[model samples]
Target: MNQYPLWKNLLILGVVLFGILFALPNVFSQDPSIEVSAARGHEVTEATPDEVRAVLQNVGVPFKAVEPLAEDKVLVRFPSSGDQLRGQEAIEAHLADRYNSALTLVADLPGWLRAIDAQPMYLGLDLRGGIQVLIDVDMEAALEQGLERYTGDIRSLLRQEKIRYLTVMNDANRVTVKFGDAETLDKGRKLIDREFRELEFETASDGKNFDLYARLAPAEEEQLRDFALQQNITTLRNRVNALGVAEPIVQRQGERRIVVQLPGAQDPARLKEILGATATLEFRLVDTEGSVQDAVEGRVPVSSRLYYDREGRPVLLKRSVIVTGDQITNATSGFDQNSGTPAVFVNLDSRGARRMREVTTENVGKPMAVVFIENRTVTEMVDGEPVKRQVRTEEVISVANIREPFGRRFQTSGLDSSEEAHNLALFLRAGALAAPIQIVEERTIGPSLGQENIDQGVKSVVYGLAAVLIFMGLYYRIFGLVADLVLLTNLVLIVAILSLLQATLTLPGIAGIVLTMGMAVDANVLIFERIREELRNGSSPQASINAGYGKALSTIVDANITTLIAAVILFSFGTGPVKGFAVTLSVGIFTSMFTAILGSRAVVNLIYGGRRLSKLAI
Candidate 1:
């Protein structure tokens, strides 16, 4: 009755082998290293590694090897994480600004194993040290910006409709449009009412001028704030990805707060800079007729602004912007074809293109300058407390005559080096933050602490598994040994599946694995108990074996399916470590059922199937 089919035996054998193969990568240790990638217009040649090696030697930082990698990259391997960090500092200090260096952990797996594309499971923040940041979004500033846009839109709308307005200005999150006549104000209000239904409007008369005041509705305000938070999360994700960090977490926390976690991030200062700075671009007329000396002496023209280029030379630029970074649809960094110098190719959206076309058509021979603007917070310690102050910088990055009037597509050159071009491309490619953000809380987890967590988690899993194996072997004898053996396979299958799925393993996830170890054999215990009951009822050994699996199958399926549903719910609704726990438990539930039911049965069948016995191992 318990005779096995050929297909069943083959299937079980295949699963064991497959599980072993994919799970093999976890056994190999990862080497601490630094990856150095060249910026635009640079290459990592054969001598690149030697130069880095020489720099390390001069700095007295020991290194195992300096090897070249694919894609204009080089890897500097270190025997210790300490040495890796020291080497990173030394290399970054010695190398030119064009090279981007990132600390990484690379596995030294065998070529054959890697040939099959097998990889280890990702470790979460608890297992890999990194940084976690809590940021507060500036919703008021976002609202003010929205109002500013509304003011501009109102002015443009009036101009398009040939309705004249005295002034359209945004003040304290409200846009007020003043008109010289009530007829024009009525027309503007009707136009605004039709176009911007989301704004709450009010009207009043001031002396001879008529005014229309507007602000966002409550629902619209909430939605705008939510959108800013979401956009910042996406932008932060892109920036972290550009930094080459692995498995970084950027998620919305509360209403106005965002939680950012970067796993395996070593350079927190660089990370802070990337996360905090709001870098953008603007294209404006160079004011060829305006005097730079007059602007420098604080006699700046009403239509112009004084700014310095990358070389710190004063330049006069029109205050009216033709285009901004927000309109850029795509940007890429490379060498310009004609000059062979570093440049950023830019493409604009329809609105920006229209603006660009109008500006270039009107001022064909005039020079247009590309201004790089950055807003950041500088922290200073005063009275033993840190105080943050906002700072804004605008520098002209490039300037060239509007040659033949181009719209939508253009390239900006004049960067000092390829690094600047690459960074500009990175900023443009990653959309700008919708509003300013304040880093309210920050914490860095060291790799050593992560190692301690891993060590403790593994030790607990080992002890729990060993205890279960010992109990089953002593109690159930032959069947117990089979259960114990299959239980071990169940663990392997779980790891293999987790590795195959590339799920992140966390400390709580390890707890889930331990829970699975105890629960994996529940079905086996049920079947074995049922078999003993059948034997007491005077059934034949073969008949009892079949009846045990057959009678317990319904209970097993019912129990496991219910647990699976709960795990799915947890996975869907949970976040962070809770999600990690759910993932491991979910995978373990399936593998546990496979090993306990099919795997144990196959072993038992191989030993005793199609045999006539007076007594059973039980």
Candidate 2:
């Protein structure tokens, strides 16, 4: 009654072999290596390896091998961490102008295994060292910008409604419109109140000038701040993706803070540079009418502004901007067709396009400058003490004569390097933050802690498995041995499944695997107990073997189904580590059920099925 078909036996054998093959990759260890990548406008040629070798030799740092990697990168493997660190430092210091180097871990898997795509599971942030950045969003700036927008809107509204206003300006987080008389003030107040529902209007008159003030409601301000926070979070996510970071955690921390955790990130300086950058571009007409020396002497024309280029050359540009980065719909980096110089191609929205067309049509053959503006913090010595200062620097990156009236598209050349072009394009494509953000705190996780976590997690699984195996082997003799064997297969199946899916295993995921070991054998215990009961009630060996599996099927299914539901729920609602735990737990449930019931039954049938035995070894 228990004899299995040939197809069933082959299927079982195939699965066992498949599990072993895919799970073999985890046995390989990683080597400490230095990754070298070319800095902007540089290429990693075959000579890169020789240059790295020579640098290491000169610095007295030992390296096992040096090889070129994909995407214009190089990898230098070292036998020890000391060698890796020393080599990385030497390479970075020596080649800082042309290349960037960092210490990273390279897996030592064989070529054949990699060829077949047999890969190990990715570890999460808790198990792999990464960087955590806490950024403070400037909510007050967002509110001020909102008020400025209201000022512009009110100016347009007054002109359209023929209600002449003397002045409209934003100050103290409020838009104040100055009117000549009470009649004009009353008309503007009614117009603003009818159109802008989110603003509260108040009026004051100092004998002659009538001043009308409008401020955002408290609820509206709160919503605006929340929107800024969310927008920054999305922007950070896009920037992280551009950096090629894997499995990043970007979430809102508080009312005006964002938390970004990038797993497996090694370059802290680059991360800081990109995430803290508030770079934008503005197009303005070169002010040929304004004298440069007069502008430098602080007698500048009211319609012109002074800025410096990358080479420290001063340029005069019109104060009115034709278009800004906010209007850019897309930006990409490439080489110019004719000049072969690095360039950034830009696309603008409809509104910006219309403005560009109007201005270029009017000022054809005139020079237009692309101005790059960035806000940053600098430390300078003041009275023999270092003081931090917030600075806004503007520079002219490109200036070209407009040949024809064009709209919606343009290209900017004259970048210092291809790297700068790429970074500028990346920032523009990712979209600017709603308001400014400052990195208030940063922490870099070391690989040593990640190693400790991995060691402890492995030990937990090993120790748990050993204790269960010993107990099962001693409790029920022959059947206990069968359960122990299937438990091992179940473990292999779990590893294989996780590897195949390439899931990230966190510290909590390790805990789930350990807990699953105990749960894995619970089904075997139930089946063994049912078999023992059948034997005591006078059933023969074959009959009890069949009866044990058949009757316990319902109980095992019901139990696993309930636990699986819980895991699914956790996976749906949880984030980060909780999600990792749920994934491993859910995978374990399926693998354990397969090995406990179908696998163990197949083995039992081979040993005791279709046999004549008067007694059982239980």
Extract clashing residue pairs from model 1.
none
Alpha-carbon TM-score of each model against the true structure: 0.77, 0.80
- Candidate 2: 10-residue stretch with minimal lDDT: 379-388
Residue-wise C-alpha lDDT for candidate 1, range 434-494, written one tens digit per residue: 7778777866554555788889998998999888888898888899999999998999999
> Between which residue pairs do clashes occur in model 2?
none
TM-score of 1: 0.77
RMSD of model 1, in Å? 5.6
**Candidate 1 residue spans exceeding 4 A from truth:** 37-48, 55-61, 88-102, 134-144, 166-227, 237-247, 252-257, 264-432, 437-444
Worst 10 residues of 1 by lDDT: 379-388
- Compute the lDDT of residue 145 as modeled in candidate 2: 60
